[model samples]
Target: MAVEVKNSESQAKKRAFLTPKRILIVVGVVLALGVVGAIALNQLSKNPAFCGTCHIIKPYYESWKNSNLLANKHAAQGVECLDCHHKSYLEKAQEGINYITGNYSEPLEKLTFTREQCLECHEEDYEQAVAATEFEESNPHDSHMGEIECTQCHQMHDKSKVMCSQCHTFSWFEELDDSWEIES
Candidate 1:
């Protein structure tokens, strides 16, 4: 009877160490912590100041501060850096590695934004923008230029130019103070 009691106690101790409930509790805690950490890091990365930490991005941050470009205007309107600069976790990780290792391009390539992305926010204003400028010459938005990329002339941080000026001379275009003036 004494031997049986000892064996049962030893079995109970072994079972206690490997209990399914205890293992599940540990896993749950780990997953919860991971979720919270990921959320915190993601929020931290979204700050414009955080982006400014990268040397390559400092110029962009400064330009955004000094220029009255769309990016800066958007920031003023409460849009955050990541609102337009979103990338997948894997892509961000790869870029981070390249930046840390000094393997990035000298002039970091500009992020290309799709027309759809712009339209997502500006769809309602598209017609108004096209109609705002009433030059006898065809409205750029309604004409051939409509098919071209918005960024071709609508720089976000720097002074926007009339891309058509490369081929054609529209004196009125030169008279415009800024690209945003087209809407005025």
Candidate 2:
């Protein structure tokens, strides 16, 4: 009887090392904490301040905050960096890796958006945009040179200019809304 009781006690000790329930609970807790941490990091990274943390991105961030370019104007109207520069989770993660590894191009590549991308938040199409500027002396939206890319005249980082001013002088551009700058 004593021997049988000793064997039973030793077996119980071995089984108590980790029951199935305990292992499942531990895994669940770890996964939950990981998810919570990821969520917190993602939310915190969305701020302009976070992007400014990267030395290469500091100039862009500053332009967005202080310049009269479309970046500052858009930020004033409550638009954020990620709002237009949408990227998937994997893409963002890859960008982070590249930033850390110093494997990115110098003077980060400029992003050019299409008319459709512009229309995502804009209520006006090309014709509507032309109509909106009809009161002005010249209609840049309806260029005789064919449909122009919005980014040509509506630069976000650097100063924006009147595309038509390359040859034609729309002197009223500067006085219009301070939106377009004189070409250098």
Q: Quantify all predictions' global Cα lDDT against the true fold.
A: 0.76, 0.83
At residue 63, candidate 1 shows an lDDT of 64
Q: What is the lDDT of residue 145 in candidate 1?
A: 49
Rate residue 24 of model 2 by lDDT: 96
Query: For residues 65-183, what per-residue lDDT tens digits would candidate 1 score against the true structure?
Result: 66678778777788777777878887777877898999989798877887788888788777788788657764667656447777767878777766666666565675666634332
Decoy 1 TM-score against native:
0.70
RMSD after CA superposition, every candidate: 6.7, 5.4
Please name the candidate that would achieve the greatest TM-score relative to the true structure: 2
lDDT tens readout by residue for model 2, 1-184: 9999999999998799679998899999999999998788688778978888899899999988888778998999999899998978788778889999999998999989987788788845556777877645677777888876788888888878777778877656656566566664
Q: Which stretches in model 2 have alpha-carbon errors above 4 Å?
A: 1-33, 125-129, 135-137, 174-181
Badly placed stretches (over 4 Å) of model 1 are 1-37, 178-184
- TM-score list, all predictions: 0.70, 0.75
